[model samples]
Target: MSEATEVKKVGQTPVSNSEAVKVANTSGTTPVDTSKSTDKKKKKKKKRTNISKIENYFPDGVYPEGEWMNYDQDFNLARTTDEEKRYLTRDLENQDHWNEVRKAAEIHRRVRKNVEGKIHPGMRLTEIADLIENTTRKYTDAEDLTKMDDPTSRGIGFPTGLSINDIAAHFTPNKGDKTILRYEDVMKVDFGVQVNGNIIDSAWTVSFDPQYDNLLTAVREATNTGIKEAGIDVRLTDIGEAIQEVMESYEVEINGDTYGVKPCRNLCGHNIGPWRIHGGKSVPIVKNGDITKMEEGEHFAIETFGSTGSGYVTTEGECSHYAVQDYDYDAPSLPSANKLLETINKSFGTLPFCRRYLDKIGEDEHEYALNYLVKQGYVQDYPPLVDIPGSYTAQYEHTILLHPNKKEIVSRGDDY
Candidate 1:
């Protein structure tokens, strides 16, 4: 995160420094004419400051460069060795996966930016969820999955998490859900798209009320701080500490009372690989003494979450997201469960998915098949993650590769 600017305008959240520069400049005074005039009186050198380009942070134009992260103060680092560093990188070096994940992340970000306006008060939650998923298809390989040169060229990797207000994550509206967006609501729209089994997982919060502005700002900064700590040699705990530090540095006020802001400790960044949304090592918002090294040639989504309530979040209500618990389990089962399992295994493998993706299932049988799979333990469920009710939460995420000497932020695009 660049420290060149500090004034963040209302509703002007930017995920990258390049974005910050544009927003900072755009939100400032009106543009002036740039006619090159040699007249001394009319000629004034307007000093232009371009913060360091994000690309130079990578080595060989692809990896992250950083000194070895310092060991945790509370935990001894003597057990960690060079072997542990290599233990973290698995199936991330392939260019195909890299390209696909980047595309998937960019597509999701593009869709979020496009459908943000549809999140206003009174909009049906189900309608908004349907729109985002459908729009994501229109923008990605799902646009022509059957006819594409490669079948894995595009499609959604996970269910769109349309969590709103007190709901933290994994809450896409169930069928015929009547929940509607309300005024002054804080909505966290978390979604993902996968290309050829490579997934790019990212999320953001859209809030219309100014009262929660500072809460959002804390999480955004915490995410940037974590991303800045991502590199080839940085320790996972170091990243966690930095994120928590940023998160706890602020206090948010709602209705004349101040609430101590903290990162949602239960939610943290994780290493992601092909179809592996939660892989490698866990990077918690608060340091928990997990001494894992961030290795070169690994892709990690550094997630930062700030909250106005308890940092701890728990499962609630029915789950919309699920994944095959064991791909090799082929025990005999009812025809409905078996059929659903077959489709899931063939289409999604081990990736987390939602009931909405089973759009082809006969409407009457969808519920029965899903219940059978869940009851049989063949499918794992992902319920909504929530803090105590009335709490406010915000999250920002970015996917990156740690190069030997530098790092590449793969998910940021021209519009970010």
Candidate 2:
């Protein structure tokens, strides 16, 4: 209903000419002292680069500059909203429930990780994807819920996000679609859910392109770099620039041509609070100076969506439903709220949710509870909006907390 919003940025303003010039001078390359020995000059230049100064990009402090997120209160409001919507939707006809959704998500993760880890090589994108989908049948209820002729109820698995090389992201398999995985393919898999009244959405990518390993590596490293640099005092834009700088340093080579990997300007990691998908304050992973800092108690998905084309990206001119955000709070509750909440509480609690629980909500208020659960961080899902063009892109996401002890990664499913 929000008009299928594209990736948006905030906390940015026009820079004065003087300011731009000063910033440019500081970031510009240093003059080479060719008169000195080549080896000595290289060492001297390295010392001058002063990687240590990178830490100065943030404000002096350990905590964020704003009020910390009240997860309990905020999530409760979000859950209530989600439940109201679920009450109006049709119920999933399949019996696999949330288990099936979880199975699919995990299976995809395994296959993607396997590819990233070199467990399988020369596998095409679709081959790897098929293996993941078929593997889910081994554990999930093997019913096609989205089929019209089938008597099975329409389930939440009707949609999925599959992004392959040059394709930023957001693709689903129709009744009989097939796409194969190929060597040097960078693959990204993102998914969502509607269990009970909760939702969970996430994504990650793998690269098989040999020439662009360093580019992929740089982007991967940037995820960690941005996370480490994130804090109460760090500007969000700084995170973007840092990632941009790292990726730019590496020449992105694909199909025998050298290119540059740009941070998908339109896509960045966002706040992950209860059912209000795309929470607040987009933390840019590519930027031009303006910044936003992380605060304690604020749960965020420090996701990295990178590309091998120009940093600027335009949408595909078409929009698809990925995850529905719950915004209605004053709506009346349906009979299924109680049952849905109960199921959600039992299955999800404070942990992330999956789509299988939608069936338990009794079809009436399933979507309503779905929104509520997402607010509770139960039914979490990643929005499918990435830059286009090029053959490959990579994504690495992790849910984290800005705590006093340290920045804690809540989703410990993967390292990157």
Candidate 3:
């Protein structure tokens, strides 16, 4: 029979008597035909496409969605009344709040994973920043938040920090940065993603040379230690002490020189509020006398930096990170500065942004205006936080949500 005829007759054709008897006699049992059953099974199977797989990440059936990260609950943190528990549960279960946070975390996790092992020795710092930011925009569907259906729904939480070597944090490339990565350099990749002002601030370190492996490991373990020790009503000092103990225990040897890792005392991770990266509380890396306790329903970025040089960071180099101040301030007298201020207020609000972002959005000749705003205390400028020259530094960070019932590491991933 022809191929088309045979395929058409698959489930409709009946077996001949001779064939049935032959099969029954050979097997010593009755033969059961399965063509119709097999055809039914095949018809029932749904064809999976790449679009379908992508759609699975979006729980709300929206485009450009992210998968939810795994979470666990800690019931032993603090005691709550039944009524309070119900209230807390309602907050935790609110899809509008927790789901947005999870989506942002997943976008961060995926963007970090996508850029891993892609940073080579000769790539420019600008290229690296673009790669990270573009990938984040693609995942969040906020390439141009102004044009989106909901302008403030999803976007970058802060400027992409590509701080290399002793440069610890708050560093990103300007419009024409020519800095190149070196094989011996230890680079810290710090970035954030935000959905409805809930930011997932996380970071990891990369090194091409094996000599700096311990540096990365030390900082990563320190951050993890802080995450583990954090809970409701846990004192920030205790968490810092734990982080310091774990960070200082390791020593790195480069070219027959042994150096102990020290936590960056000045660069403590801060709490994250709605549209606020530095919310009131600061989680120190070293034991300070700050007895502030982690409260319920608070979001914090537990970041740790370990350096071979001074465990302190000073603001140096040209400033790239800028954010509008929360309080009221006088508007600039210059028309250009006033226009730029309006743009900043409308585009970024309190979320941290970089100069390159302004350029991308077609804001030209904004240098003077931006500086004037910074000078007038209407906007805050964050220069590169550097440890010391000729030293190596590494950082690791994770954003956690302190629920009334459990502590959820929103940015937790397998890579770090």
Best by lDDT: 3
Clashing pairs in 1: 63-403, 63-406, 63-407, 64-402, 64-403, 64-405, 64-406, 64-407, 65-405, 65-406
Model 1, clash count? 10
**lDDT of residue 336 for candidate 1:** 70
Question: TM-score: which is higher, 1 or 3?
Answer: 3
Q: Which ten residues in a row have the lowest lDDT in candidate 2?
A: 49-58
Ranking by lDDT: 3, 1, 2
The ten-residue window of minimal lDDT in model 3 covers: 64-73
Residue 373 shift from truth in candidate 3, angstroms: 0.7
Candidate 1 residues lying further than 4 Å off, grouped into runs, are 1-96, 143-153, 360-364, 413-416
In model 3, the clashing pairs are none
Tens-digit per-residue lDDT, 1-416, candidate 2: 01235553686777654565566668567644443454465574432321111113223412122222322322233423555345323222322332333333343344344344542444443454444433333223333332323212112333345566666665543223445555556667664332222223456665555776766676677776666666655678877777767766666666678777667777787765444335677888777566556654455667776677655555552332324333444332444544565554433343332343233223433656655545654344543454545445777665455543234443435444
lDDT of 1 by residue, 1-416 (tens): 11235788899755754444455568577644333332455667796533222223322434222223433323334325564555335434455555555556656666766675656777878888777777777666364333445534457767887787667888887776787777767888777777666677777788777999899889888987887766655677778888898889999998789998888888888998766788768877888787788875777887787878888889998778888885566653698777777766666677777776665333334778888888879888889998889888888777777644345666654333
For model 3, the stretches where C-alpha displacement exceeds 4 angstroms are 1-56, 59-88
TM per prediction? 0.74, 0.51, 0.81
